[model samples]
Target: MEVLEAIWGLLAVALLAFGLYCCYVKYVHLKYDYIPGAPRASFFFGHLPYFWRKLKNKEVAHDLFIQWAEEHGPILRINYLHKISVVILSPEGVKEYLMLPQYPKDPDIYSMFFNIFGVRFFGNGLISDPNHERWRKQRRIMDPAFSRTYLSGLMGIFNEKAEELMKVLEEKADGETEVDVMSLLRRVTLDIIAKVAFGLELNTLHDYQTPFPRAVDLIAEGMTKIRIPFFQYIPWNRKKVKEIQDSLRLLRRTGEECFERRRKAMLNDEETPLDILTQILKSEAQEGGCDYDSMLDNFVTFFFAGHETTANLLSFTIMELGRQPEIVAKLQAEVDEFVGVRRDINYEDLGSLQYLSQVLKESLRLYPPAPGTVRWTGTENVIEGVKIPANTALNFNTYVMGRMERFFKDPLIFNPDRFGKDQPKPYYCYFPFALGPRSCIGQIFAQMEAKVIMAKLLQRFEFQLVPPQRFKVLESGTLRPFDPVVCRLNLRNPLGF
Candidate 1:
């Protein structure tokens, strides 16, 4: 009789706790009732069920956000439980939030990236570092590596790596063999970044079995998987979680080895190239402390930031060119005129390819690899005449804005003429690299490398997309083609260059 009484008493306490938690959730929901958002699917989950359903349908997540913006108007709110995100789709909102003030990145989102599955990932790296003063200090120290003079000196390295890709393409340009151009582009960009930034020879293009590239793909997959709440806790996710952890370990181990070699070189008074690695070492020396973990954070950061987005950019450009022969013809004409019979494309040549620039800009508008940036606001503000409460996450996406009818005419159409010489540039509506104080430092570097690879491809090959292809976008941490973008390549008739 006594044991039964005790069991009943414990059950009563559990029920009371559950009741209080539900009441708290209800209270929070009522607090944000003024913000326009979809009705909560459940008293506890708060829109997660609807989001999960969309994910199950294989729709890109951001596309759903765009749909919501169109339906609910520009300044709409989305909630994942207590976390409320105010997605700003209007140019005015974007200018006010992202450009005018230097709002700190949302800690809820960025802090999650500091570690993945209990392993340190991007802790204090330039990309994930939330502290403004430290980031500014690091940025100032690292700026010289991306200066115009330094980049001009990198043209030879860019040309050398691009030429290596052309040789690889030449072997496969039989016009009958189907080539996964996206994969090849990823490899080339990987090689370029490794060689140029770290002074390492990661010839991934020649060797498909390299562990480094696989590790990168796994880390990217991990980044995407980590976003799903409690993903690592599920029983079925054990193997996937283990794979992600292993990849993180491998990448960090490689970074450590590279850093050690450079450190020893510096200690021994050996000659070192003024590459990004050297700059990082110099920064550490000036600080008078050796934070190897922080150094490795940047090493991992650049390995991803320096290469993945650019590779995706080139892949999307090629995919569009394959579908539209007119665009390809124009690109070929521009390349032929500027780079006629020239094997080496110099820095001066990149500026003259105006039409090519427009094509790339159009591609970015349609498919920016890193589509959005998030900022957190600590004070209440009004945007688009809507009252946004304090402590809200302000979300800005170029992808949704680039496609919105309010921002661009015929937004769904892929037309480079929107960026033609006589056209008026979109005002605050197009920022693929973001804007204001914290815009991408490597913007010019990325575009320069892209122009070199693309100009060469236009000079040498005519590519056709494989039939029945699905031109869908995938958001795996960054945006990329859902398909591998397979194509058939043939050498240009008469070999114009």
Candidate 2:
């Protein structure tokens, strides 16, 4: 113990000396790109404490980013977790930086996830693979599956899952029952992703001992395990890596069945398309669409980015509804009024839920599924009059952007009215969907799914937050509700909506 303490003491001294040297170099020799308000150097510890404190409370990170922005102006440099990560605050800067191909997805983001998943990208869709050309090609084919018209067809899948969710709630809500709404959302989402994306009927909502459903959870949890610096580098992380791979291998086995099932269905030229698997199979049927190996990668990406993100958003939105009764009532009214006219909402109906859409917009503003988008500059560039040195990492945190006072008056308030026709936030100020060349291709698909799921939920039961239950958001790969958003689902008098 004495020797260990001695080592730690020595390490601390080394860190302190290194920090001081960086300050001296920046202050005396190098005129650092000074953003006015960034944390000035401390001899013992640079910007480390502030970064650590900010990340401890996930909600605070964006606010700190805003604070740094306010102090240093727009483009500012701050060292975080021993790395010099720059926070670019302005929308113009985001556009400029994200537009340039010189900035690519950081190796760390993929590496951490790859370590967790126990697999490498075999040329996937837009998200996982490094090859831009292959990604672009696959994106074009996969794009149609998430198009406006395509989402309309998929509404039934969401509605079905929502209905299944309600059934689970009803089954469990007998007496003083506390429901893990987030868990159910995960199940429904898993089922929906399986049915829609893989053409497999997981029915995780119904089944407990399913390989695919368990695999999904393992992947999510395993992915989180890899985020730690210890897991990223240490020898013990190898065991964790194997567990993650086992989870992914199970998923891949499921995906293989999906691949073969869809191919057979396609060969028969059946009149009915199964789901996203059908779309992928159809795309692959054409020459130069997606090769077999790449299709598997897309299957994985679709499961994670499409199913997982939407599920987390649904969970977050539901929790928000439980907390904010007023928003829930207003959204429920819109659902009732819309259903009164349309009977069953069609594609046009999905487009017309303006208030419901706005409410979701507000929810996402607070709890973005993907909190911070990061890019590493492959070349030197300037953002908001500040020159970013090549090889410097750029982090544009959506969680932070949504909270800046300059972006929205009373930034923390939950007000959907901000997005109303009378008051549209400037494009840069609001990019929950992101912007530029590599913007989310599935934005429309996500929005449509959110509106349908939330609208459906609000229609039947009034979801109330269980007293003081609240989530401290965590930006683990994607933004996630910490765990256990307990809620009370009380069924109201039968109302047609």
Candidate 3:
């Protein structure tokens, strides 16, 4: 009885200590109350309760950010558990935070990106690495792979993969069959990236049951699901977590196999395709070399980032064109003018489709993949009279800025003419690919691929948006269609001119 009493006393003391720690964390979070934000749903939980409720309803974090931006103005603060998250909605604030090298990516947030469910997803890769110098070194070494010359040489592969998609869509273009174009486009993009980046023939466009594509889908789903607190402990979530883990293992294994194959090919002095994998391997060979894990990190990063963003971009653009018929007619005319009867799209054809560029730009404005990024403020600073505390996590989101009426007139409308060659570009506000030194390195590569696929689609089909489909955007790691872009497509004019 005496021993039991002693044990109870110790347990009570431990609980008290934990409770006090929670109180202290709340105190620090509440100190930023003067920075203007929504009423806290709970003193202990801060905004997490509210955030959880929204998340449960499939609403993304950005929806609340926009609401707070409206209520509290451009630069506002909110308590996210023990952390003070300051959202920058103004163009100036975004420019200040993103353009400068002094502000590094927030370790707390980006560290989450380095792993998914304890598996190294993008571990220490260029996308997830917060170290300035190391990232710079990696970026510099990988730059040549995405150079205009190298990308220009890959036009044949892009055309081949995109045409594969066209053939699939053609079979479904019966004017009555509703097809999920987003899924089809995703498969094609996956094939393109696999071929171009790793010299692998995924053939996902023709075959969807492939393990690699399935693994990729699960990993993407897991990245979002893992963000939920106590997800692993929940009964329903355990299965999902396990699937994600299995998928990660599969991805790592495949990457290792590919790496070994490429390495041996090099060792044997056999000819190898000058692809992104070759460049990454060459980078490893030079400058003291990179480890297998880091190389795998790059493999996953390049594979996903290479394909996913551009696929969504094209998906959203196609959806927008279906909604706006006049724009479709106009874009189709341009495609017919520049790329008439041409089965293969050349690099010059990509540039000549100028209006298509504007359409793509506008689509990205509405639906930017990887919409926002967070930075850890190294020093205390004032932005437009508000005092920003040091060590705060600052968020810059194009999704919020793109919808701001101040940035673009009629911000809600999908108007391609806003990016007309004669029109003056919006300053610092429209960063679908982000801005500054940390901007997406694959911007040119992605756009080139998008132009080729889009030009072919325009020349071939007239897409009609199917009813009962919500065109809403779902904020995954990237902004994707809540419902995949479902459409009934018909061969344009039916008669070759």
Candidate 4:
């Protein structure tokens, strides 16, 4: 009888705690009632249930975001439990929040990148660093590596790597074998970044079994998984978490080994190319001491950032070209006119491939790899006649903005002419590389590398999309096609070979 009474007492306490928690969730939900948003699926879960359902159905979260923006107007709020994020879709809001003031990056979102599955990754690196002054210092130190003179010299490396891809594609360009072009594009970009940034020959294009490539894929998967609340704690996720942890370890270890090799080379006065690695080492010397962890932070940051997005850009470009024959013809005509069977495409050739440039810009408008950036606001602000409270996370998404009817005519249509020379550029609405002081520093370098690879591909092959292909976008940290973008290729100039 005494034991039963004790059990009842414990159960009463548990029920009381549950009741208070539900009341708190209800209070917070009512607090942001003024902001327009889809009705919460649950008082406790907020919008997460709807968001997860869409993700589970293989639909990207941004698609749902776009729908909400259309239904509720430009500025809308979303709740992930107690965390309220105000997604700004209006150009005015974007300009005010992103460009006018240097709002700090939302620590809640960026801190997730500092460590994944208990492994250090991108810890206070340039991309993940939230402190404005420190990020500026890091950015200043790394600017020279991406300067015009440095990049102009890199054209040779870019062309060489692109040619390597061409040769690899030639082997499978039999007009029958369905090649996963996205995979090949990723490998070539990986090779290019390894060679150009670190002076290391990854040769991923030829060897498909490289650990580095697999590590990147695993890390991306881990980044996505970390966003799901309590994912790492679940029993079923143990294996997935371990894989992610192991991948992070491999990446950091590789960065450490590379840094040591470079340091030794510098100490021995061996001739080192004026590459990104050399610049990184130089930055350390200028800072007056060795911070190996900081150096490794940048090493891992650049290794992945330098390649992944550009590869996705190329992949999407090819996917669109395969679907639209007229666009391919226009691109081919421009490539042939400017390049004219030239084995080496010079800097001047890149300038004259204007149509190719337009196509790439169009692709970015529709499919930006790094979709959006998040910022934190400390003071209450009014945007688009909507009141956004202080301590709110602001979301600025190019993917959502680019699809809005107000921003583009027939937004779903893939039209390169929208970016033509005579066309008026979209006002503050199109920022694939982001806008303002913290915009991507590597934008020019990425575009140049993409242009070279794309020009060469158009000049060599005629590719057709394999049927039954779903052109679905995958949001694995960065946006990429869910499908592998398989295509059947035919050599354009068979006789020239």
- Cα lDDT computed for each candidate against the true fold: 0.85, 0.69, 0.84, 0.86
RMSD to the hidden true structure, all candidates = 2.1, 5.2, 1.9, 2.1
Q: By the lDDT metric, which is better: model 1 or model 4?
A: 4
The superposed Cα distance between candidate 1 and the true structure at residue 176, in angstroms, equals 0.5
lDDT of 4 by residue, 1-497 (tens): 99999999999999998998878877877778899998888766788888789788878889888889889988887887666888899889888888854698888889989999889999988788888877777777777777767788878888999999999889999999999999988888888888888888888888867788888888888888888889999999999899889988988898888878888999999998767778767876786644467667877887788889999999988887878998899889999899989878998788999999999999999999999999999988888899988888999999998988989999989999999989998977999998887788788889899999998888999999998777779878899988888999999998866
Cα-based lDDT at residue 78, candidate 4 = 85
Residues 360-391 of candidate 3 have per-residue lDDT tens digits of 99998888876988888889888867888888
lDDT of 2 by residue, 1-497 (tens): 99999999999999999888776655632334354445545533457667556566664445566766776677777653345667787888787777666566665655444434446432344665545666677777776676777667777776777677766776665536888887777777777777666656778887856767776776777665654556636776676677667878776666777777667766787565547667655665564656667677667767767777887888888777666778878887888778642324566777778998888888788888887677777677776777777777777877777888878889878888988989866667566766665678778877766676676667666666676765667666578786667877666534432
| Model 2 residue pairs with clashes | 36-72, 37-71, 37-72, 62-400
- Candidate scoring better on lDDT of 1 and 3: 1
TM-score of each: 0.94, 0.85, 0.95, 0.94
What number of clashing residue pairs does each candidate have, in the order they appear?
0, 4, 0, 0
For model 2 the local lDDT of residue 83 reads: 50
Q: Which of 2 and 3 is ahead in lDDT?
A: 3
